[model samples]
Target: MITFDQVTVRYEDTAEPVLRGVDLTVEEGELCLVVGHTGVGKSTLLGAVNGLVPHFTGGTLYGRVVVDGRDTADHPPRELADVVGVVGQDPLDGFVTDTVEEELAYSMEQLAVPPATMRKRVEETLDLLGLADLRHRALHELSGGQQQRVAIGSVLTAHPRVLVLDEPTSALDPTAAEEVLAAVTRLVHDLGVTVLLAEHRLERVVQYADRVIHLPGDGRVVSGTPAEVFRSSSIAPPIVELGRAVGWSPLPLSIRDARRAAAPLRAALSAAVPPPVRPVPGGDRPELLTARGVTVAYQGVPAVREVDLTLHGGEVTALMGRNGSGKSSLLWALQGSGPRKAGTVAVSSDGPKSKDPRKLSAAQARQLVGLVPQTPTDLLYLESVAQELDQADTESGVAADGVRARTILDRLAPGIPDTTHPRDLSEGQKLALVLAVQLTAAPRVLLLDEPTRGLDYRAKSELVRIVDGLAAEGRAVVISTHDVEFVARAADRVVVMAEGDVVADGPTTEVIVASPVFAPQTAKILSPLPYLTVAQVAATLPADETDPDS
Candidate 1:
């Protein structure tokens, strides 16, 4: 349904094209997955399908992009709206209506769809995406994951022949992501809709992909079956990596297949012990921050309710839960920037007495607890990366022009151009920049919400290293995220919240291994084993075993 003939895209004042000589065909009724590293033009490729690349983004297109017999070059996005529906990374950016039901119907209304037909389609989409319960919820009041589902439902209601989604499940929890992906698969299988999706979380969607399109950063496109592409591709999920490590005959894409192939490996590792779990720091380690009776409400509705928590130095905590579970609200409350109807957030500083952060000035609060919110771009408004770093240094009271901020950024993610606009950077790069800005304050406690939203495995590894380094330096870090695999790797402790309350809090392995919803792919596949990551499994493998690929 979608064809790109020698497509090459370049922007003004750029030395190289973002996409070069990209020729690929996405067959009708197929679920095509676009895979690549950060800043690898995955978005540019998706945007081309709906004519958003050269038409709205001001980029030059060298060749033609045809979608459902309509050339995107000739038809603008408005003209192709009937055939192509696009959902972006940020759902709120595309929302025009206040409530979920209204947003889903807005697209059909724009197309002059009949009121009866629109109502029917809206109901169907609500049920398809499991959004019936949230049909009346206001858009702003919903959590990030809920907003994402609404965004997808809005596009799905249009009933376009071709659907293009960019990180559709990035903001969703495990269950929500599964529901959305299941819905998309149904569209491809039951309704014969062509889907072109780009996602950084390969583990969640790779199994559902009919075909894979690999984009190497060098502007070359490689297209093949999942096994063919992952056989040699550097970017892959843990299942694929585990298959490669164990020399499995065929690389398993799903947890079921991996588990079936893991019987012998499981038997071999039965007697071997997994690595020691990181000890949850006790009273020996100083408590850096404490919160009591924390309550956050919006318009008489409570989001976080009377929660008590503690953070200790030299530890990393993973805050996890389902959508609308008050994870973000609790993070904001802890940072002292978000609302707390009734709570006391105390930070232990040089003095023995703990000081309430909400009572402290903005500067004082930042110095005590720094926060990098879910939308890291919200903290950035500068024209260039250099300026953002400089401003962060100035605001954080760092004497050097760009020393502190730039140093932190370099340690987190190296090779980001100083002259590039902050908005133009990849999602992972933007996150690193924001993290650098927050770290320049050198707070004893650090909080990151949904930090792995757009990061690939490589970028996530870099982040894990950065978090480990921070904790080693005697700083407490709390990462609020839905990426279970990330939590398995980076967190020393796991805190699971439900309905604005902390339900489970313990060491990382204890908290996640028992829960089906939050367990990582590795843990799920190697059931009965305590392994949480591919590296952990690979560590216990006999040294004599050889990988077939090698």
Candidate 2:
């Protein structure tokens, strides 16, 4: 259904091609997964499927990309609209209509389908993706998860034979992610729809993929079965990594297979004491911020209500919840930009300041707290990355020749040219740039909202180390995320919210291990051991010794 023949994609700005010598054939009805580090050619490769690479993105294509025997070089994205449907990383950018139902039908209308057929397909697609309840909701008003569902529905309504998705479930909660994946799989099995997908969350879709494609961030594409690729790939899920760490034969690609091999490991870990969860009391550490009876409302509707919270120095706290559970609102309210109906928020800057964050000037607010929002690119507006860093230094009152911001960005993602445009950088690179820009402020309290949205395994690991390093420097960190695996490795405390109220708050293991919904892959396999990460398991295991008989 999809074939790439010596396909090389190059942009004029950079010397290297995003994708080079990518030759492959994806048979019809097969769901192919593309995996790689951030800034690799995964997105570029996805765009080539429907001719969005050189056609829409204004890049140069070296070879032919054929989808359903239609050369992408000859057909633009609009021409292949009936053959291929591409859903981008951000769903909001894909919408053409105001409401969910209208967006679903708009594609069909563009294709000049019969009104009756369009209406029927729209309803069918809505029900297939569990978007029936949101059919009437305005596209702008929906949650991130809902917007993702709507994006998929809008594409599926066109009844295209092939679907190209970029991080389809990155915005969804666990339950929503599973449902969306299940729906995508059903298209392959039941309707024979071909799919080419790219996702960093391997644990969610690795087991369901028929084949895996690895792009190692060097313009190379390696294709094989999931088991074959993950066996030695640097980018792998916790499940596969655990198998590799313990020397399990035929490395388990899924949790079920991992469990069978985990029996012995589980027994061994049961004998070892897991790291004790320490209770961080308000008195134990310096309180950087304190909020009492904080309530945020929108149009007389409460999103966050009477929430009392405290941020302590040398702590990393993770805020987790469903899509509409006020996670973002809580972060915005705490940052002092969002609406606060009622409450008192105080920051310990120099002495103590108990005023609303909204009242503080932008410069003053940064000194107290700094936020890296979900859409990291929103914080960047300069033409080039170098300019962004220079402006960050100036805004933060750093030395004119200061390389502190540049140094931080290099640590997050190396080898990015200073002259590269911020928009031209890959999603992960963009995120790293934004994070570095925010860190230049050196605020007492740092908030990262969905920090792992576009990061790969390695990038996430780097972020974990950075977060740990920051907390060790006596700076308080709060992260709002749905990436449970990341939370397990990076956060010391877990705060779960539901229906705009704080439902659970405790140490990481005590909170996540107890709830099946939020548990990491390793925690699920090594149950009853209170383990949350593969690193923890590796540390507990006894190294092999030489046998005297040998």
- The Cα error of candidate 2 at residue 461, in Å, is 1.3
Off by over 4 Å in 2: 275-283, 399-403, 545-550
Hey, what RMSD does candidate 2 come out at? 2.7
Clashing pairs in 2: none
Model 1: per-residue Cα lDDT over 204-308, one tens digit each? 999999899999888889999998999889799988888888888678999998899999888898898897544444556688999999999999989999999
TM-score per model over all chains: 0.96, 0.95
Error of 2 at 100 (Å): 1.6
Candidate 2: lDDT of 501?
Answer: 93
What is the TM-score (0 to 1) of candidate 2? Answer: 0.95
Off by over 4 Å in 1: 277-283, 398-403, 410-414, 546-550
Please write out the lDDT profile of model 2 over residues 1-550, one tens digit for every residue.
8999999999887889988998999999999999998877888899999988989889799989998889988898989999999899988888888999999999899999999999899889888888888889899878777899899889988888999999998989898899889999999999899999999988889999999999987898999998899877878888888887887778787788888878988877787887533333334578888988889887787889889999999899999998889888888888998788888888777755455567899888888888998777788898899999988988888775654788888877888899988988777788899988988887889999888888888878788877877787788999999999998888889999998899999988789999989999999998877888877776667666111211
Clashing pairs in 1: none
The TM-score leader among the candidates is 1
Clash total of candidate 2 = 0
Model 2 residue 306 lDDT score: 89
**Model 1 poorest 10 in a row by lDDT:** 276-285
